[model samples]
Target: MPSGESGHALKVESWGDPSILVTEFPDIEDFHGQLIETVLRLEQDPEFTRHFDGHVGESKVYHVERWDCPAARLIDARAKALFTSALKKENAVVDLSWASVYRAGNYCLPHSHFRSAASLVYFLDLGDEEAGGRFLFTDPRLKICCRHEPGRMTYPVGPQVRPGILMMFPAQCVHMVTPYHGTRPRITMSWNIDDKALPGNPLPN
Candidate 1:
């Protein structure tokens, strides 16, 4: 833990903890609108929600490539810069993209992307209020012992995640979302990054 971020307070500091990070810009819209459309479609699939705990609508497979859509282009370019800088690499490459949409009472189970170096989640709507869906990341160091008492041991300590927030964290860190109780569905874009993905080449694990 770095400086005053460790103890019992819920502060969103870098802390030099390679396992988590959060960036925010709540106003940027998904220009191509595929994210919104995808969320709506996925919500109708019964098989999808049960298959992956309310997750569906995975982005098309691409070879570390960028799409013509403005939002895709932004994620491709800006995300690459963010990943490369965070991982201290010159050619960080995104492996693939996926999405999830959660309605009232839907949620994801705690899990980790153990195969990837880093992972990212771009939120469209983080639910309506604190009563709705809340993204949580268990501290890997003390996940087993951590408590979820409000104003005491905020089990998942994270930054204020509004729309357009791009959250990046170590792929091996355990995280999950609390059940959403909002009227609207919660939408997000998730992708893994590989620092070994050189230009014009497949990513190396």
Candidate 2:
């Protein structure tokens, strides 16, 4: 996409209510090397555990925040360009973080990002079948105990968030990972974005 047409635009659709679509914009800015290297370094870092207080011992959710890190800057630059080219309406800023899961039963609780205007998850390493890890996105089913209306909640979910794939969505959407039975570990990087942090790049406005 041309830089001129790469300005920000409305990237969401709806099914009665607005729905965020998974978009694919070419990695024209060349952040692939940086993204891959960052994931590798972070995975190998001994201090990787330090940033994951939320999922340290018993918890399924563990995360690390690497603010303004060199790799994060590159990720942000690529994300900004894509946001401009694809989501012309939204000025999206990138906030960097990573998530780690170590066991078969590890899974993330369904929740939304409170501080971000939008959120993204980049698949890094996916554990084996025993790990049983799968990224799930569902419609409103506020109570797990109660039955949701037919077709309201999508179960088991669609699309396995595979490596090299970057998934972006509205920040408030509730999503989670299904427990993996695989013995290996599952890791993913995430970023948050908001209007203010996002630079102004209009889509022919």
Candidate 3:
């Protein structure tokens, strides 16, 4: 954790041994490739146009966001269980959506989720032995990019990216994927949770 984030920010804690916990479950289940392929095909289909570059530096080409996907729903169910078990919030819901990212010449900007409790990313097809597509945090530490640590310990968030995995963290964490020079496109799924389902223009208590 960074300085100045104390008190006002949440802190990470030990699992089972402590009250609040942070856990990491690896290989929870292998994602079906066909399900991933089907979603990818839909995103690539001309009818489902890709979003235009936002005029930012090296803007990545992304498939128009997808929310009504069966595949996405499947992942949501699993993620909900994971989140609930980890956070001890049994009633928590894993709200999320799908989006195919086409990484060419290395793209993606640093940003955080606007209205989410937590955000996640699932690597579907990031083909490369030496490709960089890490889920980075704003702080140099607490980095999800460094390496596969045994426990759910915090590290620096720098230029590190991996594939064939699902990563979850606070929604406020600033993150971005590094460029990929792989032959195949980098496809992934991302989403966040909205526990309250609050009404629009929520009134104060």
Candidate 4:
């Protein structure tokens, strides 16, 4: 388990063959309001359009590291710490950091971030509990989906979605989000991190 800045141990739960670490960020009520507002504002920025690619209607992924906000900075710092703890290395660097806001009908298709060593996601908002935007991981063994038994197709994996929960998993793990049906937007921040810096991709100063 990783200790917070105040020296309190943060609870971490791990599961699955390759293992996924789920940690509840301490005292999220302190800054979630500000963080959510910042994310919503960034989602509307026209500049993010240039960075858009892949699924045409998926939520826009904005590089929030360039923004000079305390909420974003706090998330970046905590994400890097969690990434380092998950990799068991002291020098983890975030190669890519972005935030996404999922409104009604927004969903991510199955994809993998094969370029990075690991990936991190911080749930800023989960909308309604009944909303159907659960994050799921496809069984790595493609043949497993051919089985007719229950729970053999895809794994919901990780803890239930809620604000302040941070999950770190292998970058190559295939994952996707279910279509969201809530009136309120689902917000999340993500980072692609590795033990060492990449060649062309420079770490944010």
Give candidate 3's total backbone clashes: 11
Better of 1 and 2 by TM-score: 1
| Candidate 4 lDDT by residue in tens digits, 108-127 | 77877746889888888888
Clashes of each: 0, 20, 11, 0
lDDT of 4 at 87: 66
Q: Given candidate 3, what's the lDDT at residue 127?
A: 57
lDDT of each: 0.57, 0.51, 0.49, 0.72
Candidate 4 lDDT score at position 138: 75
The ten-residue window of minimal lDDT in model 2 covers: 53-62
* RMSD for each of the candidates: 8.6, 8.1, 10.5, 4.0
RMSD of 2: 8.1
| Candidate 2 per-residue lDDT over residues 81-174, each given as its tens digit | 5445455745655553444544555566676765666677666556574455677665463332124465456453535445555566677777
lDDT of 1 by residue, 166-200 (tens): 77787777777777778766677677888765344
TM-score of each: 0.67, 0.60, 0.61, 0.83
- Whichever of 1 and 3 has more TM-score, that candidate is 1
Q: Which RMSD does model 1 reach against the true structure?
A: 8.6
Can you write out model 3's per-residue Cα lDDT over 6-82, one digit (the tens) per residue? 22322334422222123222332443455555665665465543443521212222322343555545555655554
